[model samples]
Target: MNFQINKDVLLNNLIVAQKALSNKTPNPALQGIKIEVFKDHLVIITSNSDIAIKLNVKDSSLDVKEEGSALIPGKYFIEIIRKLDALKCNLSIVADNMLRIEADRSDITLNMMDLEDYPELEFSEKIKSVKVNVRTLKTIIRQTAFATSSIENRPILTGVNFKIDANKLTAIATDSYRLSQKEIELQDTYEPMDIIIPGRSLEELTKILENNNEVVELHFDNSKILFKYGNIKFQSRLLEGNYPETSRLIPTELPIRIKFNKDSLATAIERASLLSSRDGNNAIVKLSVRPDNVIEITSNSPEIGKVLEEVYPVDQIVGSPIKIAFSSKYMMDALKIFNSTEITVNFTGEIRPFIIKGEYDPEMLQLILPVRTE
Candidate 1:
C-alpha cells in the first residue's frame, strides 16, 4: 500500500493496535497489522484470534497518494514510526512482498505478509446497538474485572457477566473467594442480553476508551461482540457456556451489619496483613465486632510475629456481635473499589459470606467468603 501520514497519528494508533498482536501465534499473519488504504480513509486491523482492533484514519488527516493494502509486521512497523524524527512518513509497497518506509533521513524496508492470509473480520453496521456512557462503562470494568478468576479451570469465571434487563445493566465478576457487582440505570431499554465478556478483553478495551464523555456503541451476536467508539472498533470472541447464576448467592438479609469508615478499615487491613503470608492460609485476618462498638483486626504469623489494631467509633452495629476471619488480600481487593467515605459490612454468620457496600451508594456491592482459622 502507498500512503503518506503524520508520524504521531500513526504511532498512536499503532500502539493501540499492537495490543491485539500476539507474538506466539502459529499463524504468521496474525503477528502483523493489516493496513488497507482506501479512497477516503485508511484502516489498520490487528488480531490475535481472541481480540481484534481496527482503527480508521480519515484522508483529511493524511496525504493519501494511492489506494492499496499491505500486511506489515506490527513490532517493526510500530518501532520505525515511533523513532522517526520526521513530521510525515511515506509508505510504499516495493517489489516481491517488500514494503519501504521513508521519513526524514530514515529509510527502512521490511517484508510484508500476504493479505489473503489474514482472517476475515467483518462487522455489520445494521446490527442492533446498545448505547452506554463511556465513563460509566469504564467504572464498571474497573470495579468488576479485577474480581474475575485468573485461573482458566472454569473458563466462564474468567469473564465479566453483563446482564441487561429492563432499564438496568449489571456487571458481575468473581473468583469464587470474592465477588464484585455493579449496577447502572439505562436511559433507554431494548432487548435483554446476558453475555460473558472475557476479563482480559475488557482490560484492553479500557485503555483505548480514554474519552469519558463519548458514548460507546455495542453490537453483539451469539459468538462475538463489537465495541465502536470514535474512530476505533474493537471486537472480542465470547466464551461459550452459560455463566453460573450468581444472584442467588447474595444473601437476602444480613443480620449483623457494621458501618465504619472506608479508609480506616482499608488501612487497618493493609497493616494487619503484613505479618500474614500467602503460602498457607493466604494472609488471614480476623475481625472481631463487640457490643461496645469497637472492631478489632488482628493477624498472627509464627514466622513474622503478630499484629493487632482496633477500629473504634463505628457508626452503627445491628443484630448480634460477631467475629469473622477472612483473607486479607480478598478484603483489600473488595475495599479498593469504593469511593465513599463510609462503608457498611453485612454479615449473616461467621461462616457465611459477608457483603460490603458503600454507605450512600447502592449501585455497587462486594462479597467475600470467610476463611476457617482455628
Candidate 2:
C-alpha cells in the first residue's frame, strides 16, 4: 500500500497488532502483516492459528497517496519503521512486489509475501453482542486466567470457562491443584451461552486493552469469539469440548474461616518457602492454627534448615484448630491479585480445598487443594 503516516502513531499500533503475528508457523503468510489501504484510514491484520487482530489507523498525520493492499514481512517492516529517526515514514509498493520504506535518510525495501496466500479474515459483528466494561474485563482476565492449566495432557483445562446467564458473566479456570473464579455484571442481559477461551489468548488480548470506562463489544459464534474495542477487533478460536463442571468442586459449607492481613500472610509464606522441600515447582509450606488461636507458617528440608514464622490472625479464627500444607507459589499468586488489604481463607478440612475471598473483591474466589504431609 502507498501511505505516509506519523512514526509514533504507526509504531504504537504495530506493537498491538504484533501480538497475533506468528513467528514459527509453517505457513509463511501468517508471519506477514496484511496492510489494507483506504482513502481515509489504514487497516493492519495479523493472525496465527489461535488468535487474530485487526486495527484501524486513522490519524490527521495520515496522507494516502493511493489505495492498495500488500502483505509485508511483519518482523522486518516493524523493525525498519521503529529504527527510523524521522517524524514521518512513507510506505509504497514498487515493481517486483517489494515494499519500499523511505524516511528522512533511511531507505530500505523488504520482500513482500504473496498476497494470494493470505487467508481471508472476517471481522463482522454479530447481530446481538455482549458489552463489558474495559476495566472489568481486564480484572476478570487478571484474576482467573493465571489459574488455567499449562500442561497439555488435559487440553480442556488449559482454557478459562466463560458462562453467561442474563446479566451475570462468570469466568472460571483451574489447573487441578488450584482454581480461580470471578464474576461480573453486564449492563444488559444476554442469552445463556458458554465457551472456553485459551488462557494464552486471553492473556495476549488483555495486554492490548486499555484501562478505561470504554465498553468492549463481545461477538460470539460457535467456534470463535470477537472482541471489539475502540478501533480494534480481536478474534480468538474457542476450545472444543465441554468444560468440566466446576460448581460441585466448590464447598458449600466452610466450617472454619480465618481473616488475615493479605500482606502479612503472603510475606510469612514467602519466608517459609525459602527453605521448603519441593514437589515439581511447588514449594510446600505448612499453615497451622493452634488451640490458643495463634497461627504459624513452617517449612523444613532435611538438607536445609527450618523456618517457623508466626502471624496473628486479623480476626478471630472460626471453628476448631486446623493445619494445612500447600504450595507457597500458588497461594502467593492468588494473593497478589486481590484489591483488598485483608482476606479470608475458608477451610472445609485440613486435607480438603480451602478458598480465599476478599471484601473489596466481590464475587471473586481463589481455591487451593492442600497436599498430604507427615
User: Of the candidates shown, which would achieve the greatest TM-score relative to the real structure?
Assistant: 2
TM, every model: 0.96, 0.98
What is the C-alpha lDDT profile of model 2 across 92-189, one tens digit per residue?
99999999989999888889999999999998799999999999999999999999999999999999999999999999999999999999888899
RMSD in Å for all candidates: 1.5, 0.9
Q: Give me the displacement of residue 196 in model 2, in angstroms.
A: 0.6
| Clashing residue pairs for model 2 | none
Off by over 4 Å in 2: none
Q: How far off is residue 218 in model 1, in Å?
A: 0.8
Candidate 1, residues 1-374, lDDT tens digits: the string is 68888888889989989989889888988988999998778899999868999999874568777889998988888888888999889999998889999998988999888889998988655467888999989989999999999899999999999999988999999998889999999889978999999999999999988967889998998889899999999999888899988888899999888888888898999999998756465788899976677999998878879989999746768888889999988888888888888888999999999999886667999999998766
Candidate closest to the true structure, highest lDDT: 2
Off by over 4 Å in 1: 277-281
Alpha-carbon deviation at 29 in model 1, angstroms: 1.2
Clashing pairs in 1: none
